[model samples]
Target: MAQIPSPYWPKGVPRALCLPQVPLTHYLQVAAERFPNKPAVIFCGSTLSYAALLARVEALAGYLTQRLGVQHGDRVLLMSQNCPQYMAAYYGIMRAGAVVVPVNAMCTREEIRYYMQDSGARVAMVAQELLPQVMPLLQSGEGDALQAVLVHAYSEGLPAQPASDEVPDVVLAPRQWADAPGLHGLEDAIAQALPAPADHPGSHDLCVLPYTSGTTGHPKGCMHTHATVLASNMASQVWRGLHMDSVFLAVAPLFHMLGMQGGLNVPVTLGATVVMMPRWHAAAAARLIEHHRVSTWAAPPAMLIDFFSNPAASERDLSSLTVLSGGGAAMPETVANLLQTRFGIAYNEAYGMTETASFLLGNPLARGKRQCLGVVTPGVDARIVDPQTLRELPVGEVGELVARGAQLMRGYWRNEQANQSSFFELDGQTFFRTGDLASVDEEGYFFMRDRLKRMVNVSGFKVWPAEVENTLYEHPAVHEACIIAVPDAKRGENVMALLVLKPDFKGQVSEQDIIDWSRERMAVYKTPRIVRFMDSLPKSGTGKILWRQLQEQEHARLATSPAQEIP
Candidate 1:
């Protein structure tokens, strides 16, 4: 029996004191025993039984260790769209005692390289659609740490179409370097590998390296232990009243924290069925909900926005939905009301981040206080502190939100500076400082006040300023660039880039061209929405781009600006 110390065991938790530290694979074991024949995952029309899913994961894990030489604590990046392969790769990595590093499939080569370099990832299992972006990284010296690139044929399990004379031409890049072997074909790897008994990891074993744009500048890999993930999953399950038969609709991308923890891991932990989709399409989501009789949905506000705006939504039956939760960003009050009035479902507002597994707070259903983020979750401790003094604030005062719990991440991987600054000892308890500015009321309900940093939340996605500026700097016509978040009626905040043209070139590039350039180089959400040419951006005496000043100026401009319906 493993004796790894559990990171999360709240004071009142009976199991916390003497909890047996088991491997991450134990979640699958419990699920298999509870409901072996239950549908564990449903992709397109194909459903994998819990037993079948566990078998595949075991086989893949065996191949990862025996064939690929993946060792414990090795980082394996899972870079694919939402698919069963993503799920398999995730559990497979955990079973192999390797860390799962999930990268957004829509990310460009430049962005992917950063994660690979930062996480020191050795292997990447990528979708065919993303091969162009990933292949360059694999070939380039930029990702020297990366060892193998496994190309996944995406349409393997999806419904097959009739053969047509017009074959879809996918423009694959020319191989520029000596191709390193050990590239596993997605289906072939699973087919050829034999199922080995589960390899259980200890509680303290690192299960995932989820990259979060923390308070420290760029994206940092947060080391989530098996205990951290299990704690988070248990907290969410209790908060949401989830059960074994809970059928979850997972249209949100599994690569993201919310989708992975809430949508994928939670279902598997609870022996529930997760009906997943590659991308979030309102019509497709509604169809899945109707067909599968989905009981739960965990998505961002944008999905609900799309659902109401989608013309085909009215045709589908969505009455089976019992638990509807929205996180990534706050849900609009009007949108929340409309969901309850029209669809007879109220949205459960949640607060969480990648560093905290996924969720830290979940508001109960139909509770009409739109502004509040509900109470602190069970097994979690939250405190408000004065920003300047770091003194704990009373219940009603607004201050920086800080949390301490078992679900909190170990720390930024090998970044001691960040770890020291992020964690502070209060009454012998080390609390993780969450940079988000919020306030707690008398009822213990929390409300988001504002951001203490310049980070932008675009449709539930965190758009780091440094990442955006890095992408904008790539353009030859651009000499200086500053990306700021401007308030939007629809999206909580939209990226607005202030550009200073190069000395030689003036008025040669258009805003649309800049947008297009960014679209080709970066992820869609990270791209700037409004591009303004400027000789110089507002800067402080220290020469730092005054992002706050820019944000205030933009807010002032938008305040008096004519109100136009956001289309």
Candidate 2:
């Protein structure tokens, strides 16, 4: 049960890791000192060097502390697309001794409001493109808790107008913040601001607060300190053999843990350049990869599917690409085979979550299997265990995969009940229960078989059924709602809503009507793709919706019939 990893490990890679002990911002500090002139981020056609980037971060840090009255341990909200402003604000929040809470930029007003109210974030640095969704929360006079808001225009931080059509229209278009009150210009503030006085936060000081869609509740914040978050970033750089010359194409959304760790944090830690993209377009990605000679890119498998299938990518110079990696969903065998035969590149697969900061297990860069997640990283202790019994299983046995490592989060923020369920004690050590059912092979390679939770993963996005069902309950025409995951051809899974309409609206409200209403109320990723009207749901005497019974029934029917239904 205590077996080590397979012999198929990277030749020069270490089995254990020792990371930088300073604050997360220290990576930027050291990078500036070592490679001041090297580009820290390349957005559009222009570049922001390490020295300039660090200066901007410190300037904004000063503004948060000196001008905005942000204090240590206080939370500051950040909502934006992948761009240069994200980098500056992320580090600036930490450098000022405040915690950074990054939320998905695509979240609806109802969802974003919950994040703001739940995190107790009074101050925020948001992109101008997303200001309309956040404008309603600016009133501190009401019960709204917002104090100060800093708005940054994506184009203002760019060197010039981006020529590529891949950039999001919101970022490409000029911002209209002319008459908006309480919306201070962040770019302008940093331009005229001075560096803040040194405020040294301890290694254990809380830094990043990333939200995760829990198994049974709304999104809960995973509290991570500077030390805990740094472990994965350092390990990624070491595991991938990244250096100053390595160029990471930032296609993954930075708001997520995987992107924050590998796409942005790993590259910045080593003074390497990150090619930031505000939006994902396969053709545009091809142009940038060819033009910049990008060496490494980590994104979702969906992006890779589009990139390789698109003929536009073939026109570009992909000779510089050496490492292509991602994790949300498994890469198809065909894509992996093509990468191996044509590009001589391995699609490095890894496993991680917001609670783990990033990669807990990864395929070796040199040696890897088509669909296997490689050995556990340097300092992690992982094993397959019986989900209900908590007993470690023998090799190749199906069980719940659990991990204990430095990359683990401190715990869920302020929710002791949630923390109690998420972690358990074993052998005098505490380990986080991943709640994902997986198995370890004789060779020590991990394989994911299924999940124990009712959550849905749509193209790497976590869609909580409870969250979606709660939203549907607010609909006037919906009497009862239950969300389930169905097989999807493109995405790994698609959200399906099974509902029993109210007597008054049985024929009045259509399925399309419910779907359309949801799109306006929640994030598109969390919206239900298919809606099924049932005569009545299988419920208990207490009137509790029997979600699992319906889910299992659907699974049994789909298993017997290969032909699947879709939106």
Candidate 3:
């Protein structure tokens, strides 16, 4: 493979620091050596030291291998929230040389079924509340590939104080094979197993199989190796200047890459204590920050919005929060500034996908930039490519952003066609097309413009929908808005803005008011001509506004409209 281009590498990332030869096992082993007595994880009022966490990982690894007959490369699905046990199960599977497939805990039965069948995961550790979602699939003879089910209590069974739960018999149905019990209690199994030595997973070994919905339309398993995970963690830590003893708040879902890599794995790599929460609640998060004295907190823009808006915001003491990072989606400028000015926390932003193993680029928390997705980190290369010509674009020119790095996925699991199209060779260097349209400034700061798929052609001029929507958001009346291209006879496509007004606004705001608002701010050709008010807009499971779906729905409505009859 050709070496990464020099211009793409971020400044200050020392080229002298060599990538580690040992895998994730090295991370855990180092933690045991350095911060053995420090709290590695804090889940549900219980804290686990690094040494104790390692002991549990070893015991669980033994149970999975010796008792359950799990072998090398055997896929084990982990479906749970952000908890200590979940981490134990994930690392345990990896330590046993088994591949870990983490499924989104909030996915519907159909969605879970697709991942379960696709990964061919023979074993699954399911949270008790989610048993209903996975039970039907497991019992319907559809997920026959699965060999065993391990039931885990999300709120129970810490090392010292175990939470109480009345284990329900009906929670699980018996399987055909009597020897393979359908529901194996995780606590019981871990309690019985003797601590075994941790197996050293090699760099080439597949560690995590994180499912991501790519631009290709469906979700696919992004095959992340031990090297990719470790490299990504190292890059993020170095770029962010995260301290080893820092306390991080784990509010993002562990199933997602942002939460898994940024919120969870990054802290573990530094031997830091992670304050865990199964789900995000603004008041609870603030309390945790005050109670745990969490030094760092990373979440989506919505989470911050909720935190600042909460009634408890005035009462909570959030002085410990020094680094407030945002991912999964863009942070609103107002919200970003409020967190910085009011809370005295720097807003750190990251830009990446599951394919890049969480973050390829991030701003340092100490001197973080809230707007742009900061410069590229070390061990990675980035370039802008022309969307149409498939040629490299100049640094300041707008084009699709592509990345090449040691952190890139091994490939989409079992999908050769996708793997082929995902990466392109330019001047003997392999670059993954990110599908996001962006540009780099003279200072190497990257700015996202819009999604190529989201670009709308109004008459002949290309109108970026995000620009229109972003401008509309600035309007006092408009709380949320989306712009789409609607078919028209006069113009090939007319710009239509869908908007939701602020709930407390007393004065009436017409569609023309929004159009006039945009007309003043933007160019005549770029302004939205058509406008429609909505009570609410549809959103994806990940909290992303589904603009394409909204556009399609508008088109469908217009296509089937009845013709007016002349009197």
Off by over 4 Å in 3: 1-12, 15-17, 141-144, 158-180, 195-198, 364-370, 498-502, 506-511, 530-542, 552-567
> How many clashing residue pairs are found in candidate 1?
1
TM per candidate: 0.75, 0.81, 0.88
Instruction: Sort the candidates on TM-score, descending order.
Output: 3, 2, 1
lDDT of 1 by residue, 1-567 (tens): 111122332233333222237656787878988888988888766677888888778888887787777888889989877777788888988888899998877677888888988888878888777767877666666536566776666556544541221222221222223335545676667887765535567889999988874544677889899888888888787767788888998877787778887667888878889987766567767777888899998876656755865766678888899988866445655566677788888888888888898888666543535755666776677878887888888767768888877889999898898898889987678888888788777666777765667578988987767557755665777756677888887888888898888767787789999998898988888888888898877642112356667778878988998975533
User: Which segments of candidate 2 are over 4 A away from where they belong?
Assistant: 179-181, 454-567
Q: Using lDDT as the measure, name the better of candidate 2 and candidate 3.
A: 2
Which residue pairs show backbone clashes in model 2?
none
Q: What is the lDDT ranking, best to worst?
A: 2, 3, 1
Instruction: Write candidate 2's Cα lDDT for 1-567 as tens digits.
Output: 474668787777788886667887888899999999998998887689999989999999998898888999999999998888899999999899999999888788778888888889888899887877887888646676677889988888664656665667677767668656667788877986767757677789999999986656688999999988888877777788888789989877888887787667788777788887777778888888988899998876656755876788778788899878777555656566777787777788888888999778888877677566678887888888898989889988878888999989999988999988878987777889998777798888998765677678999997767567767867877756788988777888888899988678989998899999999999998999888899888742212356768888877877798776655
lDDT score, residue 362, model 3? 69
Q: Which candidate leads in TM-score?
A: 3
Query: Cα deviation in Å at residue 487, candidate 2?
Result: 14
How much is 315 displaced in model 1, in angstroms? 2.7
Where model 1 places Cα greater than 4 Å from the true spot, the runs are: 1-20, 140-143, 159-180, 195-198, 366-368, 454-567
Better of 1 and 3 by lDDT: 3
